[model samples]
Target: MLESLNESKKLLPERVAEQIISLIADRELKAGDKLPNEFDMAQQLSVGRGTIREAVKILVSRNILEIRRGCGTFVCEKPGVVDDPLGFAFVKDKKRLGLDLCEVRMIIEPEIAALAAERATSEEIEELQRIEDEVKELCDKEEPHMHKDIEFHEMLAKMSKNMIMPNIIPVIQTGISLFINITDYSLTKETVRTHQMIVDAIRERCPQAAKDAMIEHLASNQDKIERLSGL
Candidate 1:
């Protein structure tokens, strides 16, 4: 149940949406958790059912909640930032978008690797190794390993153990994927080597080594992308 809203407040729907978002952030709600029915929420928030519906609609547009015809509303798995999360559509220069995304990866991922090294659970470490092995298998077969490579990075983000990082990394990665597809990129042996270096550093729990490895990896990729784009 929620607290009563201030009677003097205007825009009750917007305020209700803010409170609901706060509730999610406070962990009173979580991914895939079903929200109370609209009538109950209206009662709890001391608003009319129409206002509650409007608030739910707002959250739905933000990818925070989904309503099933008969099953009621449930929180999204990622909870927010759906559909072109980086706002690439608004950027008039797509090539600049690619380079900017590379810069972002260079900045954020190394620290994420460092955190994963410091905080990954033993099982999480094993999972990373498992993904690496899968990529190696694909590499050996000379198959398209890009999807597996993306999965490996995505899992590394999950292993970082930073609550907010897990949410943001996927959005950034989506931007990176767009850049990669635009460039028609291909994997290189050096890329595999760098990935191995990062995995080994994390496996040994060497945070600095993991961070350095990731920095090198992203820097190399940036250089390659720049070359391919003739920039």
Candidate 2:
């Protein structure tokens, strides 16, 4: 059930949106769960149907909810997580941005690999191996493999079993895209080899080895960036 809003509040739509969000939290609505219809929702919140519509629109824009043509509005798979949360697209110098992202990854990702090695389930390890193989196959064929590369890193983050790890995936994804574009996929062999090494270490459940492999992998990328940037 939703709480009735104070009529005197300015920006009633915004206030109603807050109440709806609170109701979502209070009700423990999972992703893909549909909300009550507009009329019912308005009745429950003691607001006008038009107000509820405005509030829902706001939530949809924030990536908290999505509207289906036939189906009702439902929670988004990754609530509150936007595609470009860091506004990386607005940055003019992608080479510089890629280098900065690599620095950040070097700081955080090795530890994430270690955690993944320690925490990954058997199924997760198998999935990681599959992704690694996919990347290798793509590289051997000289096909586009950037998406698989991104998937591999995202899989490692998930295998870390840290709730917050997955949330940082947009950053990792953007960094990988930038790196691939800037480097022109020049490190195909290195990419295949390091991905194999990282997955092998994780499969063996060797935390230190995984961490070391991840460091080597990222270091290779960083080295390439430095060379290209004349740093």
Candidate 3:
């Protein structure tokens, strides 16, 4: 169910968008859940179809919704999280950027891994293992595994089960990308080894082991950056 908007609202589209977001929360819609058609939404919210369209566009820009041609608008996998939330792309000095991201990861990711060991469900751990396996396979074949590596880290964040953890994914992703580019995959073997250690620790539900493994994993990246940058 949706609420009707006051006609005197200064920005009807914005008001309508907020109402639609409320409707989404009220209905407990999950990612990929399709919203009611434009006509239906307009009728329910007592707004013009144009207002609904504009509102949907706003949600789309915020990464909360996606419009699929010939289908319908649905929630994003990581709703309300933008692709580059921290604007890492605009930084001119990538070497410094990579080191800085490594610093941030050192502070946050080990704790995240520990939380994941504490909270992740069996199914989530299994999924993480699958991603880890995929990454190792790619690395063994000397193929491009950066995406899978990013997926592995992202899966770890989701396993943390902290509402805020998933929002930090883009930062982790950016850091991973920078590491791969800077190292030129020179640390592939070390990375794969540390990833397996992390997965093993998580599978055994050893929080300290998982935390230490994550720290080692990130520290390896930092070391590589420092050595390469002649620091």
Candidate 4:
């Protein structure tokens, strides 16, 4: 997770930047290899041209990509070690910025949970149940289950069956790094109860119960986290 993010904080353009870079590295987009044009790349990447352009510009400055006049940008053969956007040492700080980001996630995720409960389908419910079981196993074994937790939440959002949900989901994921409360050491019975309640409500197709459960679960933590951190 941190590795993906380590590269991400450097690229800042969007996930498309990461997507493009990964393709270049994994697909071996060689030097002088003419890319299919902007529109084509956008279609292939399944994103807008603006996202591609932003990614390309970032790559260009990093020297991993070079744009030629009227032709196209080509990958670098041995793009000299690209300097880190913040001097190769952009370690995530857990101080001010971290807490601020966590506070924002608290505000967004509860609503998403409610939406999920309101709209989840049978298939999505099954998927969410599977994720919950996996998370519970990981937690029981005292393993680092942050990724599973993230996946569970993401699946729940997708189950919410709201089209607008895809966009908001990533924002919540962005700050999941500082989620020290997720690991087993801090996984209180109350937390498990809250999540289980959400799952039960969603399974029952009770939207209001789901919303109420989520709000009740999150509001306490939200207030506590905010007041304690003074966010």
Candidate 3's error at 116, in angstroms? 2.8
Clashes of 3: 0
Return the TM-score for each candidate structure.
0.85, 0.91, 0.84, 0.55
Higher-lDDT candidate of 2 and 4 = 2
Q: Which ten residues in a row have the lowest lDDT in candidate 1?
A: 179-188
Candidate 3, RMSD to the unseen true structure = 2.7
Of the pair 1 and 2, which is ahead by lDDT? 2
Over 1-231, each residue of candidate 2 has an lDDT whose tens digit, in order, gives: 567877665699888888888878988998999988899889988888999999999999989989998889999998888777888878887778877888889988999999999999999999999999999898889888878888898899999999888789657667557544545468999988988899899889999999999999999888987887777
Clashes of 2: 0
Error of 2 at 114 (Å): 0.4
Number of clashes found in candidate 1: 0
Query: 92 in model 4: Cα distance from truth in Å?
Result: 11
Q: Residue 215 error for model 3, in Å?
A: 1.3
Off by over 4 Å in 4: 1-103, 176-184, 219-231
| Winner of 1 and 4 under lDDT | 1
Q: Which ten residues in a row have the lowest lDDT in candidate 4?
A: 1-10
lDDT of each: 0.83, 0.86, 0.86, 0.66
On a 0 to 1 TM-score scale, where does candidate 4 land against the true structure?
Answer: 0.55
| Steric clashes per prediction | 0, 0, 0, 1
Local accuracy of candidate 1 as per-residue lDDT tens digits, 76-123: 977786888768778877777888888888888999999999999999
Error in Å for residue 5 of model 4: 35
